[model samples]
Target: MSSRRARFGVFGVVALLAWGAISVVRPIPERRAGEVISGVRTPAWQERVDSLQRGETVGGVLSRGGLTAQEATEAIGAAATLDPRRLPAGMRITLGGPEGAPPSRISFQLAIDRFLHLTRSDSGWVEHEEVLPWATDTLVVRGEIARTLYDAFDEGATELPPGARSELAWNVADIYEYRLDMSRDLQPGDTFRVLFERRRGPEGTVRIGRVLATNFASGTASIDAIRFESEDGRGRYYDTVGKSLRSAFLRAPLEFRRISSVFGMRRHPILGVWRAHRGTDYAATSGTPVRSVGDGVVVRAGRMSGYGNVVDVRHANGFVSRYGHLRAFAKGVRSGTRVAIGQTVGLVGMTGLATAPHLHFEVLVGGTQRDPRKALASTGGDPLPSADRPAFDRLRADYLALLQRVSTQIADSN
Candidate 1:
């Protein structure tokens, strides 16, 4: 989480910007109308860059780039692998050909990792796809909690790409969901450090990739997580001793948010009578996504008396979790639908027996309601297999060593 500004080393910024493989592309100039000049036709290699407008079709983009109707249709047909309507607005397309003639080459980036090339052949047009390589670098960011993790990330990750800090915070919280509740566990003086991947694509777009290693410290308690993949082919985070960070259930059903009500005897907001509150209420805005706290099949998804719209998921451990006051169920979520941990199931709402927009979450064991916090805390994660311990140990050692090197550099810089 974030309070103190993390040290983003000057070298890291310079190294990221100095990727030798990344180069700026310039447009080719237009040539004069061809007239026999010195009996040798001067080949006019004209290039134009056009962006796809909103609600515009591929044919429209081709026509605007000087392609005839017939040529545009042929080009579209040649690139049948790409869905023309699926192309997002602001996608840049490059057209190149002789001046005053239809383009011979059409190019566009389909995604950060994919590029499409359409070229005119002797018989017809042909399409070729290219994979764009990204320049990747590992960087370190350290922050101290002030008010919340979001604040810490906003203040500390100034060197990160716009909008990336928020994503990083969410991802960090997700990695430790079973071990820590970001909304309540972190204090003002708590600290966090991360070693993460920064990738830059051909368009100079920067994004946060994988988190290689991270550590969080609150008072005398500290937790360190390192990324590792075992022979089982599943990649996950583990502690220094190789214990997994993932548990059967998440600490909470929603992302970091304020708790409006806790489980206990309380006066009913609607009935105005003292009663047992069998669930925890999380105060959140309507339309905010609510996720399943664990892997389970939905046993029920319909309106319940006083609960409004609700979903009941039955986990493998015979524990049933209930989410109530949902605005709408996510697509494909219904009775008998299997859901994975952290999968979105509904949206927060105030439909029945509620005063404001909030989620009423409950955990039931043996057909009886239990405190979600205490129930989830009783679960635990698995440890690395003895056969895979050597590989995990090697990865953890290397990652920690790299993290320490960066910490030393930060200390030296200050």
Candidate 2:
């Protein structure tokens, strides 16, 4: 019995030695650097890394990391405590195993500071908060009006979004309150441009800020720029090179005109109503320009039943003016368009039950309409600075001389 036991033991030793030799020669599989080995004997570390990168949100990251939904949630919770709800739309994550072996487990961390770590859960990317950065850039846009200002903006060439055109018109009126009245005299080929600031949001939303500059050109006359200036520490509109744009009185008080049965009310030419005449009736020549008597805003511009193509402007210091019986409107002339003393607003035509072409012009103090022709209280004069008057006079003289030369040349050609 002892000899048989010895033989069995010897056989066992031989078998163990043979196994050791085989192990020494063949060796067990080992992981390379940056590689992970799993108990399932699969090379899943690379797949997991790829999955995490493809995830748009935290939850997606965990699922791609080879974790079940619940497992990924819990793992992500433990790793970053991020809230899935607050996760950003386009975030990426990376994962890696310990060196020299397949990764048995992995973890995640956020690099962007805006991401707020939330509670962890069994589900992937359970909770998180994302904060956005503030914007500090400025944007500018310029446009021209040909034929009509509204049509130019509304045609979508300006590339502004909805409601931008109205806002732009308002800005022009606000800045050039003393220069342009868009109702009466805007010719078919008149042109204009504006400058302003734009703000953008993190979500790619955009909005316009304050208007910085504006230019309006008509015929041979042009107002180059309307800008903000500080003189004596007081800010006001100045020209392109810093000159006052204000004047004592506006060039014209009414926007556009045509002769509508003369100044007297005789049998109410069109209405047949017997009423006392209070103002002159200028005939509207369809597409004629309308000018503002003074700098003001269009408090009203539209139809008033019998008055057709009516426009009313409210000026500074309790002054108001009205224009009626027109054919069509100038570009950008609306309820809030600002006008200078001589700015053209609309064209002339016989509208609103008019018997013939003519503008019904009226000036109002407080709220009562009065005779515009008689109400001419000579206002608006040069704003030449007392200290700079001499210089301005000299410049003006030189400019006049040059203008005369050009005029003579043109006359010679004619």
State which candidate has the highest lDDT. Answer: 1
1-414: candidate 2 lDDT, tens digit per residue: 999999999999998988979956776578799885654644433424432333366666656554567765565556445555565444545444434443335433343334434333344334445665534332333345564455655652254565666566655555554455454345666666555455444655555555545557777866644334335655455564446766544424443122222345667866677987665566545566767776789998899887799888888866678778878777899998988767777766788867777777777877877755445543333454667555445544443333323121111111
**TM-score for every candidate vs. truth?**
0.75, 0.37
Candidate 1 per-residue C-alpha lDDT over 1-414 given as tens digits, one digit per residue, 9 for 90 to 100: 133233356656766766643576344356688843457677789999999999888899899999889999989998978888788999989999988777999998778788899999898999999997887777788899998888899887887864888888888888889988787667899999888877777888878888889999999988999999766776799888888888888988888643433334568878999987887877788988899989999999999988899999999989999999998999999999999999999999998888889888899999999977777873347888899888788888888877766442222111
| Residue 190's lDDT in candidate 1 | 97
Question: Which regions of candidate 1 are displaced past 4 Å?
Answer: 1-45, 53-55, 121-123, 256-279, 295-306, 311-320, 329-340, 343-345, 363-371, 407-414
The per-model lDDT (C-alpha) reads 0.84, 0.57
RMSD of each: 16.0, 17.4
**Which regions of candidate 2 are displaced past 4 Å?**
1-28, 31-144, 155-157, 229-235, 240-361, 364-414
RMSD of 1: 16.0
Q: For model 2, state the Cα shift of residue 295 in Å.
A: 12
